[model samples]
Target: FSYCAKDLGLVLLAEIDEAEIFKPIAQLKNQIIVISIIISSIFVGIAFYVSRTISRPITKLRNAVDRISKGDYNYKVDIKSSDEIGHLGHQFDEMRKSVLETNRNLNMLVKERTKELTDMTNALDATAIVMVTNRDGRITKINQKFIEISKFTEKELIGKNPCIVKSGYHRTEFFEKMWKTISHGEIFEGEIKNKAKDGTYYWVKTTIVPFLDENRQPKQYIAIQNDITDLKNIEYALQEALKRDKESAEIIKRHVEELKRTNIELRRKDKLKDEFLSMTSHELKTPLTPIIGWCGALKTPRILGDLAPQQRAAVETIESNAVKLEKMISDMLDAQKLDLNEMKFTIGEVQVDLLFNKIKKDFEPLLKEKDIQFIIRAETADIRLESDEARILQVISALLYNSIDFVPKTGGRIEVTAESRDNNIIFCIKDNGPGIPKDKQEFLFKKFYQVDTSLTRKHGGTGLGLAISKGIVTRLGGTIWVETEEGKGSNFYFSLPRKY
Candidate 1:
């Protein structure tokens, strides 16, 4: 180191230190090391900044993708950045929602389909005799109903041809037609007769439907059956009943013809009987008329010679009985006329008071003989009826005689009254006599009905007086009725139309 300055040697030959010569180089080296350390620290801070902004978000996205791959749609991809990663996270959440909804819909659709199939199967089992067969007509499946109705066990029926239950009633052509229809994939419906294991026959309304393959040919058949055994029997019974009814109708027609002939004969006989009665009554009345007249003449002193008391009494008795007989014949003729509707009425204005007076006068002698009290009460003073005057007198006389015969011999009271009633004139004959019983009162107006049937009874009547009176009053447009109680007296009333 001293020899470098040897040309100027004499002055620099003295001691130079090594440390002082290398001091600046050592300072430069220290400055270079400090700059390297500062650069390294800056690079480390940049790496940390990149990790906070990008690496953490990418890691979160990776974890989200992992969760989504495991079907964890509930986990939220909550990247809140306004960058592509945030958009990606939003799209992934939407996809997860869509997948969840699709899964739910799929589950619902599966349940619905399963339920429909189950219901269809159960309905087939419950209601019908179901049978499934292959194209070869061998039974593959049969419902419980088929087994129960056929009286065949499942073991015996399965894999067997449907001919096992065939009844001989159906011909071979019947089954051939059914199979031909089904083979062409058509449905065949008919009533089938089948024999059971118990040797009994049953009928079924059967429908055979073919399940077609892609080529439109039958691969299998499903035969649905409904038992119609009872219906067939009912149809047969109805046919038999109709046949019997036809026979009965012919018999009834013959009976009706016979009845018509009998009815005609009866009409002819009734007319003949009426004619005979009329002739007989007229012939009998002719003889009685003269007898009644002669008896009256004998009783009169002026017409015939005066007789002794005994002779007079006998004549009077004959006259009275002859009068009774005449009255009976007249009643019979009147009844016959009424029955034939041939009675004639001479219509005229009849004063009710005169009619009553005539009734009182005709019955006066009998009333006096019985010592009965007779009263004539005319509530209608000038009431006049347009009717046959002679017939009115006859009815009044009959009712008066009926009352007089029944009244007490000593203290009998008879009341004859003519009163104005609603739109009519009412004539009532009341008697204080033994009242008719409740049960016999209704029959008092019938022909030949006698209230007093005892043999020892004091009253004597032909039982036709009231009946004839009723007929005459009815002919004159009137109604007759009697009111009587067991202990009370009797009142007989007849009403005639006031205008008539």
Candidate 2:
């Protein structure tokens, strides 16, 4: 606010008390409060009137609109006030009733007209194999076509399992997967081989679709099958005839091919020989362990306490050879199981530091004997992972053994390191050894393969250690590979997902 004073020219202005000018309003404070309260009450009354006359009826009509959109013509607004909105509500209810009546008659007409088409489809069911099996795999219904194909009477099939027609052609896992898929309301389509009542197998291109209930769970399975036995037989006959025609043309070249084929057969036989040796080693070690154990007991200080120097030495020799045999037998079994994918994993969380410490102790004697430098670097304190601990140990030990065999005898260096890689742990074993050549690296993981096959090869092995290591690593959801040049050190790296 600006103020102007009409004093003597530029003379000092006087102070003024403005409270007196507003004294009337201050004295009428109660009256002002009363007027404010009356204004608020009036506004409240109008808002209440608008809500009942406008918002309420509109809300009911909006709900009715929603019901109509969802195909529920039976919904109506029940507003009964004597106002324009109430009149509109009554008119809306009349329209809804009219539409509901019309819709009911229309739906009845549709079903009646389509009944003939549905019957025609039912009549055609006799031409195709239609069988219904409940979720439990029990036959619930089988049409004439199904009975004709299976050679079973409707009475015999009504409550029996669908496995009555199984030909034993597929594995148990196949059926397990089929049930798992259909039980989740998915369709399973495949070429199925079935056995007839006469013990003859037939082929059918089959599709089983699940019928789902309101909860989306399969209530039953509808199996529609098309007989493909004749087609399959024709395909087999054509393949055989083509094979014969090719064989006739290759008669002159057969001798050269025979030589190559013979080499393959020889290699196959060599594989069998290794497997036999592995089996034989297992048998030999079973008895040898008991023999070695008894010999040791005889020379012990407490059990059979007394022994001559030569006797004690002989007993030690037996024990030493027994340990070697045991190691060989274990390697054989591991190789066999790994090659056939027969190894099972008992997965659990493994503390990396504890595992590495145990491995260090196991290899301490070997390191001292060879005068080799063994280093273990576990980078993190809380490093743990989910895996088969025994298999993981086996793979690491195999890598260490390979290093021990090939690394320089005087100044060999082997380093085992583990560190976290994002959500996984990377394990690496590096060795300063006679490095492998590029040509030999590719075949290093093949069963019974070796870089050197000569009798006097410096590094002695059955040539299955790395292959078994690779197999174990792969099965544990990890990849193993050796990085080496012709003269540099080799680094074997594998990674396992870390659970913690």
Candidate 3:
């Protein structure tokens, strides 16, 4: 190795252990690698510990949130780190419980609402006459009430046109108006007359509701109805009754007018008959006055000439008949004047005693010839009356003559009496005679009215003496009446107002 100074390098190379010399450096390099590896191991261990502390809990929270977000509320955020993450997990769990409670309440509310809707539908089906129609106006559903009224089965009515129940009462324009309203998604309410399956007619109050689509146009229709046929029938009956009443009223008005016209005609005829009777009686009385005067003059012997016995007897008979005829004519004229209200009266005071004496003297001879006793009675002497004296005497004379004709020829009795009573002087002519029948007494004062036709002819009276006497008494403000019973004595009474 130290070989010769071949060079200093050769001698230095003979002293060099290159392996031993590089040993410390190699040791140092190894030492540095080991330290570097140890420090890296420590850092990795710390990193792993930090990730377990922070990232593991964060990952668990994220997974729990993910499950909760997926609607898996049963999953729990179970971070038990005693850090902020555990508190956050507790709050999240509370919020989940609140959300679950809210959901459950909402479900219960939905169930309750659904049940209420079902009950309402059932009630509507039972009570209402309900019908539903599709957009094509075909029947889709109907209730029992609808089936009963329409008299149709469910199978027959389903999918049938609503016009199947038409009564032909509504015109086309009516349905047109209804369709127009519903087509615009409106509600139509109205009364409809419809016919049943059995041809019976009915009325209904209907409401149509249109269901609209998203575009706001009607997609379908539903109808509900109730019966009103009875009301309509009653209205028709009332209209007919009112018409009949109006006709009856018109007929009654016509009959009343006819009756009024007939009554006016009868009044006119009665006035004409009264005028004719008055005119005829006056004409007959004028001619009778002269004949009665001539008969009286012919009976007097001195006025004409001395006559034989038979001639005198003939003249007397003629005078008597003429006097009776003249008296009858005078009575007829007086009766006619009373009917016309044309009789004249002279008012004065009449003395009762003096009037009675005159009547007694006038009828004395006739009373003797008939064998009748004529008696005059004065109940109150000095009796006075406010009346026509001549009319009073005429009334008394007619009654006396009537009695004289009817009295029994052999044993007849007559009395003429005058009396004063309250506010009147009453003159009564009573006689025992064959009295007038009660049924005929009322007609005795009427002109030409006699009790018996046979008795009037036998007595030779015109049957007018009583009529004239009543008319004269009435004109002097007095009343005349007779009280008689068949086969009994009769009393003729007349009263005039007493004037003080």
Taking the tens digit of each residue's C-alpha lDDT, what string does model 3 give over 1-500?
Answer: 35656655444336768899999999999999999999999999999987887788889879988987898877767777777777777788788788778878988999999999989988888777888888888888988899999999999999998889989998999999999999989999999999999999998889999999899987788897777789878987888887879888788899989988888888788777667655665666667678767767777777888778898788778777767766776776677677778887778887888888887788898888878888998999798877777878888888888888888888999998888889988889998888888788879888787777773466667788888888787767788898888899899998888862
Query: Which is the winner by TM-score between candidate 1 and candidate 2?
Result: 1
Error of 2 at 257 (Å): 15
Question: Model 3 segments beyond 4 Å from truth?
Answer: 1-276, 454-457
lDDT of 2 by residue, 191-280 (tens): 889999988889998899999999999888999888899999999998998788887758747877998999999999988986787679
lDDT of 2: 0.86
- Candidate numbers sorted by lDDT from highest down: 1, 2, 3
- Candidate 3 has its poorest 10 consecutive residues by lDDT at 4-13
Q: Using Cα atoms with residue i matched to residue i, what is each candidate's TM-score against the true structure?
A: 0.51, 0.45, 0.46
Inter-residue clash pairs, candidate 2: none
lDDT of all predictions: 0.87, 0.86, 0.83
Model 2, position 11, has a per-residue lDDT of 45
lDDT (Cα, 0-100) at 424 in candidate 2: 83
Q: What is the lDDT of residue 275 in candidate 3?
A: 73
- Model 1 CA deviation exceeding 4 Å by range: 1-263, 302-304, 454-457
